[model samples]
Target: MEEVAVVTLEPWHPWPLVFPAIVLATGAVMTFTGHLRERRWVRDIGMVLVVGGGLAGLALLGLLSGSWDQAQRAEALVGLGYEQPTFSGGDGIVGGAPGVIDFHAQRDGELVVGRLVPLGDAQWQVVEGFRDSQPKDSGT
Candidate 1:
């Protein structure tokens, strides 16, 4: 028998995508109704809505995809007994490395900062050493 650690990823919410879908449906209906009524202006507006909504929806999907991936990686680190493990990179939309994880852990009876990187197979390795969160000038 072999022992290995396993970390499960959290699922992303699908509700955010629903609004874009609704927008698309509304645009399609508008276009159909406008065409049947022979209103060119209404049809043009509908077309604009469709195109704008489609492009915006595609952009949102891309952003959400990145957020979901980062969230999953963060969850995996949390599963490894890290406290408050969060996805640390640039802004939520853009950032540094793919698997940058910032976490807090207790060491020697004090809270310290730590970093981790994924090593595949549900395994993660701690980066270097833990750093004291307090200012050096502050004596504890």
Candidate 2:
């Protein structure tokens, strides 16, 4: 088998789920120990830790998922044969309505503007512009 080089860092990469899991486990152990030892402070601290870790885990999951989704959307847009695709609004998170993003890119010296809408399961629908029109005015 041939070996291929891999890029370790990318937008779609998922955060390490292990750290949050470990934190949750530690907090649970601490809570159980504190309860057994009848230490209210320790138990309270453990509970706080548990809640914090749970929240962090949830946040990480949401962020990673959003990033992944954005990356996929970007890839789909790029695959449309446009060069240097730039998303309007923001990157790494969907803006405006759900499943919609404003984007612009160039093909054959003409700028194309459109909205990308996810058609479920990695499929995307390109809406609006991409006509055979002149470049947009720079409003100089």
Candidate 3:
């Protein structure tokens, strides 16, 4: 039997993208607290922060998405030791065109949609990755 080498990836770094979400979430918490306390100033400030943070954070997500994709590709290539390899990805949309895909390859690559299943007590596996994550005719 051929042995398949396991490529281990370090812990994922999500801090860059999490900070904005935290800010937006903070706005919500403050808003709720202010409303409960009957503090108009806090409520108003919270509203402003929520709206502003939501918009800004969403925009940042778009950028971060690209960055995340690049990083994933880089790491995978390093692990596989390939000069150019492609993985599934989607359009700017989270997981590609909403329910149409689970993930995308690049800005214009094929979209992949699938659900994860529990392989064991502490193990999970992606159905799509095991089945149809390969490039067909895109020549990626």
In order, what is each prediction's RMSD in angstroms?
Answer: 6.7, 9.1, 9.2
How are the candidates ranked when ordered by TM-score, highest leading? 2, 1, 3
Candidate 1 backbone collisions, by pair: 90-95
User: What TM-score against the true fold does each predicted structure earn?
Assistant: 0.52, 0.60, 0.40
What would the per-residue lDDT of candidate 2 be over residues 1-140, giving only the tens digit for each residue? 11111112133455576788788888898899999999988888889889988998999998877767657656665665667777765223345435556677876778777665554444446764633234568899
TM-score of 2: 0.60
Model 1 lDDT per residue over 66-123, tens place: 7886677666645555555543432231243235355555444555465555554445
Candidate with the larger lDDT of 1 and 2: 2
| Alpha-carbon lDDT, every model | 0.61, 0.65, 0.52
- Residue 61 lDDT in model 3? 72
Residue ranges of candidate 3 with Cα displaced over 4 Å:
1-14, 68-140
Clashing pairs in 3: 88-104, 88-105, 89-104, 89-105, 90-104, 102-112, 102-113
Sequence-dependent TM-score of model 1: 0.52
The reply for model 1, stretches above 4 Å from the true place, is: 1-4, 78-140
Which is better, 1 or 3, measured by lDDT?
Answer: 1
Error of 2 at 28 (Å): 2.0
How would you order the candidates by lDDT, starting with the best?
Answer: 2, 1, 3
